[model samples]
Target: MKKKLTGKTALVTGSSRGVGRLVAIALADLGCSTIFCHGRSEASCRETARQIESRGAKAVILPAELSDPAQVESLADRVLAAGGVDILYNNAAVMHPWRDSPEELSFEDWAWSFQVNVFALVMLTVRLLAPMKLKKWGRIINLTSGIDKTPQLAAYGASKWAVDKWTDDLAAALAGSGVIVSRLDPGWLKTDLGGPNADHEPEAVLPGALVPCLLPDDAPGGSFFRAQELRNFSLD
Candidate 1:
């Protein structure tokens, strides 16, 4: 059988390591010939590209500070110059130490978190959605966290809530526009962010991340999907 994304080009943000790295590789294996793996550093992004290309696929490495809208615009322009983006997985995220109480969070920290976690995502989608619309087909999959499920953190959870709302509103905004907007929570995977005690491995998140990008046109939209249970309302 043919792979789901044989001719597709996927851009997996923050793909230097952890869940992002795994997701980029999985998409390549699924036949995404052009994989754009982005990172804060060139060396890291190059390593991700190496991992993807070793599997017999072409890849592009984009070094970007996603929090900066200017850099994001440049990145979007470069991608548009190269070709169309078929699948976009907005997976990068950051937060202050959870040890800090609500009152302890500085205004600066909160602002920075939103810029990176939410604003940059919106910019990327806005730039790419038009092209996707022109073609009348595309997938926009935002990588959200389980924070909304267990909300002890402030800035992090708030940003994800914004993402959840964006996916919902974007889906409605793009109705009849042929662009599907959705999110995938890869569970509590053990990584630098998830900590060593997390329930699942980093690899477990890939399939869940990949599923929403390949959702059928009639499938549910503005919803969340988890590896253990994929049906609607199971915020697992």
Candidate 2:
């Protein structure tokens, strides 16, 4: 089959299931080889890789605990070994239940949440940026959360906000360099993280959420985006 992303390769973290899984599948279907990284579940990771391969894109499964910096570095090495990652989907995050109450949350809890959601995400991006810059073409999609009102999810929300701000800044730093960085809010969806009561299904993120990652090299970055539309795409 003819492919739009024939030579590209995408590394999607937390892709063993839910929205990340669907995104990986969609990228593979578009003809981009995929690298699936998921923590704690080898079976699930294998399953996702199998699906990606079945769609005709090569699949690589590399499991690494995001909370650990050493593991994150190891994963980066493996990704670099794959001839450099052209697309990076920062979809992994930690949202512990204890974070539901700020008064009851401990310093350790907050630190752990930030470690996975912010530190590791930033670390992995820093580690991988060199190759993308050298190649002069790349897409870095950082997933953001839209539930700002969740008092119980303070850590998650705050960390996401940090990433959103970082994405905005990174876009400016990467301008004219052929590397695009954008924040994508997938909206509240039915996933393990989103819970069963979320208004939309995980599949709802497709077509719309995928648009930013598919933008042209000359497209401006550091923009915010909802799954439904680019934050800066004016209808007027």
Candidate 3:
């Protein structure tokens, strides 16, 4: 039986556990042949790979500390050597220890969030673009959070906004080039980062969250999606 994504290969970052793990499995279940699972722990990545293989898909563990430029470059080199993938899910991110306010937020917190959430994402995408552009087919889903301003999570929110801006521009640049870029706001869910107080469960992100990743060529680009719905929201 031919599946929707049978011939596709995907790189799902931060896929060791939580929503990242679920997303990787979902893609695998749909018949993605090669799934690159990124995380800090080799054991977790191995577990994710096992689960992906259980779905009859190939899983390759790609471990890297997104906060480290050298490690990120190494990861990119490996992916390029393996042949770039058809889909890139920039799901990994960091929410550093909170400070009372943005002003109180230590430089380390701001730097860490941006390094992982913003800088690493850009670096990986730029590295993968050559293959995607040449193949004339690709999907880049940049995971983001809501627009709400939480003083406690100031750096995190700001980092997400940066990605939001980046996605918007990249979507426009890739328009009509057979590659689509979009922002996916997964909403606050009960995950390691979201905590137990979150309203929804990790599974609640399914179906809708995956929608933008599988968009048709003619589908609107540069759209901000909140789960399944396209939103007209702003970072400011």
Task: Output the number of the TM-score-best candidate.
Answer: 3
Model 2: residues with Cα > 4 Å off, grouped in runs? 98-100, 229-236
Model 3, 153-233: lDDT tens per residue?
Answer: 888999999999999899889988899988888888899998999878888777666776677788867788787352232
Judge candidate 3 against the unseen true structure and give its global Cα lDDT, from 0 to 1.
Answer: 0.86
Question: Number of clashes in model 2?
Answer: 0
**lDDT values, one for every candidate:** 0.81, 0.81, 0.86
lDDT of 2 by residue, 67-172 (tens): 8889999888888887778889998877878444678767766788899999989999998999999999999999998866776767777889899888988988
Looking at model 2, residue 153 earns an lDDT score of: 69
> What is candidate 2's TM-score against the reference?
0.92
Clash counts for all predictions: 0, 0, 0
Better of 2 and 3 by lDDT: 3
Model 2 local distance difference test score: 0.81
In candidate 3, what residue range of length 10 has the lowest lDDT sum? 227-236
> Which RMSD does model 2 reach against the true structure?
3.2
Work out candidate 3's RMSD over C-alphas. Answer: 4.4
- lDDT per residue for candidate 1 within 201-231, as digits (tens), equals 8877755677787777776568787754532
